[model samples]
Target: MSTTPTSTLRFCLRQWSAWAPGLETREAWSGWDGTLPHGDASPKVDAMPAMLRRRADRLGKMTLETLYAPDIAYHGQPLIHASRHGEATRTVPLLQALARDGAVSPQAFSMAVHNATAGLFTIATRTHAPVTAIAAGPETALAGLLEACSQLADGAASVLLCFSDEPLPALYQPYADTAEAPFALTLDLVAGDDFTLGTGAACTEDATPLSLLHFLLGGETALPLSIRGGWQIVRSAM
Candidate 1:
């Protein structure tokens, strides 16, 4: 039998912020009592300065809002931003510009890239600490969590993990495997005794990030998620 990596995540999930269509995420998340709603999420990032807010697309705005979510001001460095499709909103426009004039605007090109939000977050907060940006198709969240756990194991005090995504650009809409409505969630994790995380090879219907979100926000005792190669990401409260 092929074996997969397994370890106890051993982290205190201090706080989280999530937003989705027609869902007052703050209120619902405060209690973990609401279902994932359907429809376009109302995009609003009140914490960001107006100018910088305007510069970012929907995904960027969500990531920043979740990063700056109330009361997470003291979290340690090394923010992890995970997504299946990164900066897709601006991808089409950039491709169009390339097709038309063989040149793309420096400013648009910068914001449309995958690392744009993480880069902007550092500049906006003036925190030089490291930030990781990851894009791994449907396995994005699983991979991101593994990386974050590894970092914490390496002695980092805490990590801010944000999984955010929006619909693929219209030009590539048919390839989407996630919900039509965009979703963003951030977790402030620090190695502790409050939680235990484990993973193995299995299958499930729920998406990885969503499965984790529901478990944490819902206070479930166990969670199982599907991954490529028949692997499973499992969790339980300690």
Candidate 2:
């Protein structure tokens, strides 16, 4: 419950793009009522080259679509891609194939790794900028955001932060503890003081990527998060 500005992390959001079923537009997402929508919501990924698009799974497509969305103008900024479960849907099947048939396709094995989507993005865009992939349980989004902000503080002009997750397939649904839909969010962030992330009161609310998106969308003045030792994001005082 310590609200100190001295240790606050500060940054400015240049632009953001989010994609989900029936919530592709900011106007549509403004109506989100804390309930994730249910539907196909698969990303088109038409911007990706044909070969890459064919190789990308649903989650990969979602991530690429958000990063390449019309609103996001990528200028080779370093990328930090985060997901609580990176390509889980793809990995599970690979595991099953190994268990059942005692072997799996080598090509599929390559894409089943945690950094597949990030690698695909770099290959597609031919970006030489550094790329970092992260997976930190439920704190995945916060970890990615913090990394981007730290890059800015370390002399980087800007950073591209992306988070993507989809509902676990039916086989793993029973083990799921949190509610989520097929969604991806991309943020173009630069050095500034428009917002602050600092220590905050403890609460039960989880700091899911969707929660961060709502705060960025101006739906809330302060985002209360109970992860990573209790944190919050708010507009810096003028």
Each candidate's number of clashing pairs is 2, 0
| Predicted structure with the largest lDDT when compared to the true one | 2
Model 1, residue 17: C-alpha shift (Å): 1.1
**Number of the top candidate by TM-score?**
2
Candidate 1: Cα lDDT at 68: 75
How far residue 225's Cα lies from its native spot in candidate 2, in Å, is 2.5
TM-score of 2: 0.93
Cand. 1 Cα-lDDT: 0.72
| Per-model TM against the reference | 0.86, 0.93
Tens-digit lDDT track of model 2 for 81-101: 999888888888899999999
lDDT of 1 by residue, 130-232 (tens): 8888988777766787778878889998888888887777789887666655777888888876665465545555356756787777655555544454444
Off by over 4 Å in 1: 1-8, 30-36, 74-76, 229-238
Q: In candidate 1, which residue pairs get closer than 3 Å at backbone N, Cα or C atoms, i.e. clash?
A: 200-232, 201-231
